[model samples]
Target chain A: MGDVTVTKSPDGVWCLCRLVRERLKAEVEEMKSQFSGFRPGLVVLQVGDRDDSNLYISSKLKAAAEIGIDAKHLRLPNTTTQDEVLQSILSVNQNLSVHGLIVQLPLDSVSSIDTELITNAVCPEKDVDGLSCMNAGKLSRGDLSDCFIPCTPNGCMELIRQTGVSVAGKHAVVIGRSKIVGAPMHDLLLWNHATVTTCHSKTLDLPEQVGRADVLVVGAGRAEMVRGEWLKEGAVVIDCGINHIPDETKLSGKRVVGDVHYASANQRAGFITPVPGGVGPMTVAMLMESALRVTLCSLTGGRRHGNSSGVVNRK
Target chain B: MGDVTVTKSPDGVWCLCRLVRERLKAEVEEMKSQFSGFRPGLVVLQVGDRDDSNLYISSKLKAAAEIGIDAKHLRLPNTTTQDEVLQSILSVNQNLSVHGLIVQLPLDSVSSIDTELITNAVCPEKDVDGLSCMNAGKLSRGDLSDCFIPCTPNGCMELIRQTGVSVAGKHAVVIGRSKIVGAPMHDLLLWNHATVTTCHSKTLDLPEQVGRADVLVVGAGRAEMVRGEWLKEGAVVIDCGINHIPDETKLSGKRVVGDVHYASANQRAGFITPVPGGVGPMTVAMLMESALRVTLCSLTGGRRHGNSSGVVNRK
Candidate 1:
């Protein structure tokens, strides 16, 4: 009998945090030396003080600080009115020092403040979150120049590109279709020349579809919903889902998990990302990159004015 | 052996032209009775004398006239300057009588006029082509309530929905990725909850991918590229391709064909759209529909004045 090759052992998830951190730190130091009083300024607007929102804001601020970017957190009470949020966004938009502005999502869904209206109010130039219709439209049309890509999907793309697998002609299956992650990921993969398939909660044959992927990106936000057995051999798996489940073993009585079953997926998959350290750090890194881009555009007067060529002119 | 049941013959392409035409005519007659001077006025701007563009404009005008809509063909010389085209568009945009304006595509590509710039110059309200960033972005974000969906893809969707197949949970494979048909088709299908896979020139295993689809939409514009043998059993095929090939047998010395091999695909497919009679008529019909929508919006004072609530909140 031909010797059975042992299944390749679990390769450690690519440690992007250190690499991105060092690069950002270097960029910041160089900028400081070249241009005095030049620091990228980012503001995070939060309302209702959700616990998870607080955690996300703190991590973002820490990442910004590490890279020498000035970060501010603007908090609003649960009772904040729509006008109040819009007024704050307008003021921040006018602030020349604020290079990037992000309104933290899930802003009290029960409240009268329309999320879409508030997000659109942010100056497109400073819309670091890239949720505004203008940026989303530009991204959908495959125009990346001078556009801020949403951080999570952008980070996921960076991770997939780092795998050294050419995206062109590859079958990439994305699970989930949220505006932020899944939809943008679909566009990004399509733009990179991948035969992309998007499977959501409505997908009938999830296993069969997932099994067909050369590169599988799961962002369904369900903890460990994707099993390892369904993965194609040598598939590159990117888990964008960050879910927390109760765990008696931890002091906090909870542990973070991704959409994929990491332990099992690691065995069969050629490349897989672990939940906590994989996509989380990369999201922060991409945000820093967005901030830097916005800052540079502001400095160089590359800020797009009204009714210009919105399509990215591909040379 | 039990009777093969003949694998159900290919159903005739849903004749959306007749349906849309009849409905539009009814609406126009009703409007004539209800309000005087309420005819929907559409202006077609042709920058060059392209034969195909001429044919398209004539059909559009014929359709508009049949429905009591005022249609004007504004022919610009091939030597028309960019400013002249822009000036014409601006005048048409300001003309209160004109509800919709479309600049025929491939308008003197040799000229200094940038197609993107020219198209973007049209007021989004009058952009019946729906190629503007505003409409494309709104469509991408799944906000279809107030957006003018690009005609061809909208027609394709209308045909598919007429097939009585629920798009949700279907594995829809779209061949082609052009901004006009394929890209928008992908978004429309995705919005309808289909697990959509976009296959283009970069697709390596076209046969395998096509075989996996329960619903296949082909718009590669190549003459009969997809064969029946490659299709999944009982798959519904929507061919958006319109390609011409020389045939000595015809007096015109040419015949029109689709991206799919009709003879072979019709044998195995449960539903198949014929080339000349399929998506082409639907495209014209949808264009008329777009004009009517814009006109009604204008008459009812639904004209969006500002950036407030871009999402079309249908009453």
Candidate 2:
């Protein structure tokens, strides 16, 4: 057998992340000249900060800073009411300076908050997180050029593009149906002309289903639930899952793993993403890309130049 | 081999149609008693009379009359401008008397009209046709209760329910990706807990795809494309295509057929919908159902009680 290719090395992810950020930085500098010191702005709204949420938000903030975006962290008290959370979002929605808004999920609140309602409160135009129904709807209906796609799936597409395997006429199996990942990924792939099958928790014979995939994307949230033996040899496998498994050797006594067993899966897969270095950095990178696009569109007073095929063609 | 049971016999459709109409008639009569002669109203806006459109409109009008719905045929001239069409829909959207509205497609206008733009203008509230991006988006995101599902797929689900085969966990294969049929059908089945695979023109190995389905839905618009040999034994086949083929014996020198080769498919399929009396009649029946639902929801001053599971559980 030929040597197996790891889809993304730690260095490779850092390189790609650096590439996207540097490009954005250059663009931001160019915009400063064209628009009289105009800066693209983003707001990350968080409530009742869960530790994991804080960590994720911090990563996003760090990325935004690196890319020269005017980023703000709008942290609310843990006891913030739903209406109060909504008011915060609405204020950002009306803020002409802020071009992008993302609500940090799993709101840590003493009061019962409706996550869907809160997510939908962000205006579709500024919804860089792409969780709002309006944006999700636009994405689902093959209006890829017109809506903001969720970050993970968008990043996964970018990774798949790097593999140089044409998505058209390929069999794409998406493992999960979460609004954020699996569902939109299926739409993106289908519009790209792949025959897409979505398999979830209830899917009987998961291995059998995964075997037919030329491209398999797993966001099932289960830790290494998909075995290497289930993969079709030489398939392009993208693991979106970030599960924590205990390991006595580690200082934290736990190690991060993806939805697929990386060690075994790499033996069979033509390409596979490592849990830490693969989709994680790319997700943050895509968020920056989206934030930049939103900023540009707002500044230009026009819509995002949507690609009809739903695939990012940017070199 | 097991007996090949036809999904919808002409008599069965007639019976089902009558049952629904009679129930609707009773409901209308009850509403008359409560609201003092408030008849459920529907407006069918037709632009440029294609004969097929006319025939479909006539059937809708007939069905509405039987159900005591005050159905109006709003016919516009072939030379009508797109602006005029939009104005017509906008006026209907504001009219309190009208609860449901459908624009007959293939706008036979002399001037080029943006169909998607016009379809979106119908106001999601009155869009009984469910072609609007808003409704399509809601349906795509598994928000089945909050959206009007396109009638054909809605009716297909009703037929599938009638078959007593559980959709959940089943491998459902849908051919085609048109917004109205295949795409929506995929969403509907996926939400119903089925493992759905959507195949279109770009799909490789169509037969292999078909062979794996526990439930097969074909709406490729190509006549007799799916042969019996491709089907898994006892597969429940739902054919949504209506293509006219040469039949010299007929007075019109043509006959209607489905995407599946019915005669041959019956040999392998445990349950299969016939061409003329199958999905065709059910589509009309579903349109009537949707119109009635919109009217009832309007009168109730509350949202229609949406079934989260998305299957029509009405006996």
Candidate 3:
């Protein structure tokens, strides 16, 4: 047997994230200059005082501000009525200046308003979160022309493409089936001509199925559920899951980890994304890009008809 | 090795087709009886004299009639302008009696009419073919309540459910990526919680991929492209392709064949559907059902708010 060495190279997550962010920032600056007094606006609606939700909202707002986009965070009480929240969404949707709208997830579990109803309330054109039935439907139909793709999945695709790995003809395995991530990811991969297999909680023999993938994307939401040996050698791994686990080594006694056991995956995978530095940054960047796109479309009259030619080249 | 008996069961294409047809007919009859002088109407728009298109239109019209629905076939010349076709679609869409509209496929290839534009022109409420971007998008988002699913994929799902096989957690491999068949089929399977893999022309090692499927759905539109050994033992095969191959033994010099080499597949697959008898009959049955659904919705006044509850339970 010949001796073989597997080099564990960094997947360049930070570099790619910076590149995407810088490009979006440049576009935002250009748009501002092209149209005097034009500022891309985003309204984020948050219900309840959940710490995590507040944290996410602040980060999103900060990111938007950094890119020279005006971001508004609308906070609602946990006991707010369903109609009240919906009315707020409708008002924001009607605002000509507010080009993008997002309802922070994990609303009070007991809230009377249905999550789906609220999601659909946002205007499709300005739905930066891409959770509306209209956007999801457009994405599924392989019509990327006017739809806002969900941020995390869009980011995952961007990262995968950055690796210079051709997605077409590759056996891609996606683990998860959430409407926000797994389902759309599967659709995107299929649209890109990758032979895609989706695995979820119901999937039996997960490891065996994952082993077949040349490109494995795990978003099952469980921390380190996927072990190293489960992945095929030389596989391109993208982890979209972010779960906080107790860690004695950390000062805060907690650490963020992905669905994959990164150490083990790194040993075998040709490319593997780290939990904190990888998909998280990309998600925010994609959201900024989506917001900019909506703003541009609004400034130039109604929705742009064909594929997204302005910023995100889906093809 | 101990002697073991493996009984190859009949896929029951005819039985399932008849069952679905009878149910749809019953629903149509019930609606007719409940609402006096109410006749569900369907308009099929065919843009060419293609023999295959003519055959499909006739079959659809006949099926609608058998179910107590009024159907009209609008034949347009090959030289018909795009504007004329769109105008026809818009007129039929506005008709109060017309509950279903289908633009027959393979519209004159040389014609300048854009198929996508024409398909989208049909009111989503009356688009029985489910080729409209709106219907396709809704179906992809797992929101089946209001959208009409594409007939072939709906038929394939119905057929799979009829077999008494549990689809959840099963590894399903779908061949082809057409918007009408393969793409929607993948979405339906994924929505049903199956581990779905979509293979297309770009796919390498097709046979190996096929071998991994517990359920294999082929719609590549090629005749006998998949052979027996490619399938996993005891695999349930759903062949959606309908191709005519020249045959010396047949009086017509052509015989209908599916994407799979049926004679060989039958030896290994636990259940296998035949080309002519399998998915063909179900497509017409599904169209009749879709028309009835639209008719019922109109009678009830406007689109039904929730999941399809009356006749077609896509779930």
TM-score each candidate: 0.91, 0.95, 0.90
Top model by DockQ, which number?
A: 2
Candidate 1's residue-wise lDDT over A148-196, tens digit each? 7888888887777666777789999999988889988888888888999
By DockQ, the candidates rank as 2, 1, 3
> iRMS for all predictions?
1.0, 1.2, 1.5
Predicted candidate 3 versus true structure: per-residue lDDT over B222-302, tens digit per residue:
999999988888888899988999999999998989999999999888777888878888888877778887788889875
Candidate 3 CAPRI assessment class:
medium
Ordering by lDDT = 2, 1, 3
Looking at the true structure's interface, with contacts defined as alpha carbon pairs within 8 Å between chains A and B, what fraction does model 3 recover? 0.77
Error of 2 at A206 (Å): 0.5
Write the residue-wise lDDT of candidate 1 on B1-315 in tens digits.
Answer: 121222232324434467778888898888777787578899999988998998989999999999899999999999998998999999998999999998899896457888777877999899888888777777787777657778888788777766677677889999987768888888888877889999999999999999988889998989999999999888878899989999999999999899999999988887778888888888888888888878877877775221111223532
Q: Per-residue lDDT for A1-315 in model 2, tens only?
A: 133333435576567667877987898889889999899999999997688899899999999888889899999999999999989998999999999999988899999999988998898889887888777767776777788888989888877776777788999999999988899889888988899999998899899999999999999999999999999998988999989999999999999999999989988888788888888888998898889888888788867644222554432
- Indicate the docking level reached by candidate 1: medium
Judged by lDDT relative to the true structure, which candidate is superior, 1 or 2?
2
| Top candidate (TM-score) | 2
Tens-place lDDT per residue, model 3, A1-315, is: 011122234447877777877887898889878997689999989998998888888889988888888999999999988898999998998888898999999776445778888898998878888888767776776776667788888888887776667778889999997888898888788777788898889898899999988888988999999999988888888999889999999999999899999999888888888888788888888888888877877878756332322123543
Between candidates 2 and 3, the one scoring higher on DockQ is 2
Docking class of 2: medium
Backbone clash pairs in model 3 (N, Cα, C under 3 Å; residues 3+ apart or in different chains), count: 3
DockQ of each: 0.71, 0.73, 0.65
Q: Candidate 3 at A122: error in angstroms? A: 2.5
